[model samples]
Target: MSAELAVVYAALILQDDQIEITSDKLQTLVKAAGIEVEPVWFSLYAKALAGQDLKALLLNVGAPGAGGAAAATGASGAAASTEAAVEEAVEEKEESDDDMGFGLFD
Candidate 1:
């Protein structure tokens, strides 16, 4: 995190490994890190999360650590565990296919 990134708040809407950070994150990143945030941060944060995945989530970034709120990740983050399981299943299927010579071109 750069000095510019320190004070600026960043939020990401992630689907898969791809991410789209809200506009506020953009400004927060634009400004120097460790800088105190103005009201603009909240306003933009709301606008960015509005009608998106955030409506269902209760997020708090009050910690002195990483920007990702531990609260946001609670039980909801459990869904991500399924992603790993799904990947494992896919790999297993691929292996089975390979063993069966399914990938061999006729």
Candidate 2:
């Protein structure tokens, strides 16, 4: 497996086993997998997640219909904002198609 994938797998294992996902734990898992990864990468990952709730983050990510359900559960305002963004993106794509200067029926 690629280095990044190995690291992710290690994190997943930690999550599954209800162990805290720490840089030390990540390093231990990676080493057990017989891969050499830079210590800085583990440190960075741990730092990035340090103040956040991993279970909530993971739930938001792994839940089905994540964009809708997760948004609904977390922040209604964010859900509305996300809807607006999707509509805007669709509108932009439609406008670009029109800019091509031809219609399928023509």
Candidate 3:
């Protein structure tokens, strides 16, 4: 993994453990996992996340109401309507008699 991503993962682990996020903690986790990332990455991530509630923030990152089911239903409905429109267009094109100056017996 990239050094940057390693640092983020370490921070997330710290958050999951309910441990206060700090550079030392982040570095410790990263090193324990056998990953070698620059010290700067740990410090930056720790500082950025110091006063934030990672869990709450993560939990809020999605559609606000009715959750995944609503999103899935909307997507399926749109797909069905689009499929019907495409089928109608194809039928009309097939039924056209013009045939652009070409004929089956030509």
Candidate 4:
């Protein structure tokens, strides 16, 4: 699949945040991205963390809000984490940089 055509979505499940994104709704994206969801596609088995604090959880999960300390810590770690994720994503893509959509000249 072309890197430009891949579609990725991140989901953050928060307590009291009741929102459902059914497969039917996501089907178009999934299809366009050339991805197939397995039969057991959704995760419903993550236990709440107790006493570890939000900062620790964020660092582990690598979520922006979670990594910014329990309240507000430095953004260095979060920035590094984000950089790493972006690098990884770029590496995962098989297309050469030139294959990306943007034209060099209009």
- Number of the top TM-score candidate: 2
lDDT of 1 by residue, 68-93 (tens): 55446665564676578899999998
| lDDT, model 3, position 1 | 91
| Cα lDDT tens digits for candidate 3, 1-106 | 9898888888788889899999999899899989998888888998899999898778877644545655676887857866898999987776674466654555
How far in Å is the alpha carbon of 53 misplaced in model 4? 18
Model 4: per-residue lDDT, tens digit, 28-72? 445655676542332221122222243444557744444337336
Per lDDT, the best of the predicted structures is: 3
How should the candidates be ordered by lDDT, best one leading?
Answer: 3, 2, 1, 4
Tens-digit lDDT string for candidate 2 (12-92): 788779888899999999999899887887887777766666667876775546566555666776677779989999998
Between which residue pairs do clashes occur in model 3?
A: none
- Candidate 3 Cα errors over 4 Å, as ranges: 62-106
76: Cα error in model 2, Å: 13
Instruction: Quantify all predictions' global Cα lDDT against the true fold.
Output: 0.52, 0.79, 0.82, 0.43
Please list the Cα RMSD from the true structure of every candidate, rounded to 1 decimal place: 12.6, 5.0, 8.2, 14.4
Worst 10 residues of 2 by lDDT: 62-71
By TM-score, the better pick of 2 and 3 is 2
Model 1 Cα shift for residue 56 (angstroms) = 22
